[model samples]
Target: MSKARLLLATERRAIVGLAGLYATRMLGLFMVLPVLALNADHLAGATPLLVGLALGIYGLTQAVLQIPFGMLSDRVGRKPIIAAGLGLFLIGSVVAAQADTIAMMIAGRSLQGSGAVAAAIMALLADQTREQVRTAAMATIGLSIGVAFAVAMVLGPLISSHFGLAGVFYFTAMLAVLGLVVLWKLVPPAPRRRGHRDVGIDRGQLKSIIGRTDLWRMDASIFSLHLVLMAIFTAVPFRLVEAGIAEPRHGLVYLGVMGLSFVAMVPLVIVAEKRRKMKLMCLGAIGTITLSLLGLGVAGSGLVALVGWLFAFFTAFNLLEATLPSMISKLAPAGAKGTAMGVYSTSQFLGAFLGGVLGGFLSQQFGLSAVFLGVALLAAGWFVLMLGMTAPKHLSSEVVVLSDEHQGDALETLMARFADVAGVEDVMVVPEERTAYLKVDRSRLDTEALSRLTGVRD
Candidate 1:
């Protein structure tokens, strides 16, 4: 195999490992979805509010710890941090499994939540792959999440019915153990690298990035993406059960709906990427989600609601899933991809927490209609916000790997090269990072010619 092909294979394996790890982690959380309220009441001192807290505390801790853990991975190494996080998760699962009261369960779940693996995963992927292929790597991980979520929704009730909620915890604990095994046996050892320089926020630079009205448009779009997602899921599972689909079969509906949605999403993704119409695709997804929410809010039949809402939900969900990260990569300050993602992820999780807590409270305080209405409002807002955002121009990158002695003129060389490359439209070179990033029009540049020009053989 060529070097690029070999690297691609390695990236694929790493992504597969990530899928397993993420699926295991997510399954533990999603297993509670079908039975949370019904099952929680049997435990000692359980209350609706406490149940909501338990449901959301994972996101809270996950949000808080992600960047810290990611930054820590820069020091302690990815494997060690990942192994440790999984161990913590296992411990928490065991604690929750054996808990005698709601308070203990919450504590155990909180501990489980503290095992934030996402940042470490991203950092590891970065270490292994070139920037050109990093997005593909990320997409693999994203697919894993989508599949894991589908599997969990289906299996949750079955596991709960057969082994009870504690059994679900036990299963999660076991999955963590399996993840540790994969980390040791399957994953390639990470190469040693210099620690990341602390990119202390520059007030002027920060203001430029954030103050750009266009960047805010993308940020708002992402925030709104997660908000609608959380708000809708707040009631979708319960709505499924109400439709006479029993707990065990909940996954079937999820699997079917998500399966179809995934299939449907592919064509659109192709058109967007190939035709270079990402902005249009993004807006279409938002509109679809809004209509789905409205349909669910008013549908008289369960089948109608289920089919309509799922179609709408997954259509938008998958599109945003793909688009948001791409936009961020294109939009962020060149060297601070990690920092930008940290902020984006934190916002995403915060939205999830607020959606669940607020959605639950609204459902309890008012009714199902009220829950849908809240979601519809959020989706509508997202749709309006997305209108102002522009599509990313292209997908290719201009990468410069600096030599030790050539550091002095690295930025100048990069700027000159950026101007020389036929398709290069913009450039950002960080001397501190010894990296030069370029955003270019792929169609305008013959990639083979450029690679030869740059001596970067594929």
Candidate 2:
């Protein structure tokens, strides 16, 4: 096999390892959902508002820390940051497990949220995989998250029933220990930051990316995505119980619907990617979400709400979850994928935090109807924002390793030459890593031309 092929295989293994690590963390957070309200009162001083604050604090910390942590990973290396984050997560889990008071539980959960690793994982994936295949690698990780989420929701009740919420924390701690092993045994060694070229984003790049109206729209779409997601969960479980399924059985309902929705998302994603119809898919998801929430706002029967609203919400949620990353991947300047994801992830966590807080407040003040109505409005706004977005033409980015000699003036000269290549949209020359990050139009760019100009073969 070729060297590039070997490297790709190695990267794929690393991605799988990382996927397991991600699943472990999410399982800890997700398994609490089925019974948070039921058991929270036992912790003392628990109210709906307090429960909401506890749930939302994780997102709040994650939103604040993910970008800096990700950028830090770029500088210090991926594994160290990942290990440190996982350690913090383990400590938080243990703290929560032993908490007798809601205040302590909230504090533990906040620290757990502070163990933000999404950015580091993404950066690692980017570092290991070439640009041409990075999206596919990313998609693998996304699949893991969705599957873990579904499985956790379904099993939350069963797990809690067997071991209690504290038991869940104990399990999470055990998994964190295993994660440390996986990090060492399975994760590939950090690709030497070549000094050939650096992929790190600076203040100027952030300013440029944020200034683009199109990018802003994409950010808004992500924020809206998570906001709607958290809002649905805020009310959906209660709606399920009101419909007749009891608290413990809600997990079964989530499991069933998510299973079917997971299957459905596959073909829809294939159609969107193959057809290059991201805008259409995005609009369709928003519309579906709006209609679903509207139905929930008006529906009188639990069954009617479940069939009309819950189904619509999950279907749309799964589809949007799959497409949003792809759209961001397409829209971001090729060399700036890390920066794009940093902003995207920050918005996502902020949305989750806001969703939980607002949903709680709305439900407390105006009833569930008001919460659904708010979600409907939010979805409507997303649909409008999406409507105004120009359809993104499909493209891919690649990371090319270069020799250390290609630094300074020589790298700039190479960058100038590479920029003039037909179909190249953006190029970042990193002298530190000896890598050139290239974003290109596949149809317009000549691959052979790139290979010849760069003196490298993929």
Q: All models: lDDT?
A: 0.71, 0.76
Model 2: residues >4 Å from true position, as ranges? 1-3, 6-12, 74-77, 126-133, 189-191, 194-201, 403-413, 431-433
lDDT of 1 by residue, 159-178 (tens): 87788888888988988899
Q: Where does model 1 exceed 4 Å of error?
A: 8-13, 130-132, 194-212, 403-410, 431-433, 446-449
Instruction: State the lDDT at 78 in candidate 1.
Output: 88
lDDT of 2 at 156: 71
lDDT of 2 at 217: 85
Assess candidate 2 and give its lDDT.
Answer: 0.76
Choose the strongest candidate by lDDT. 2
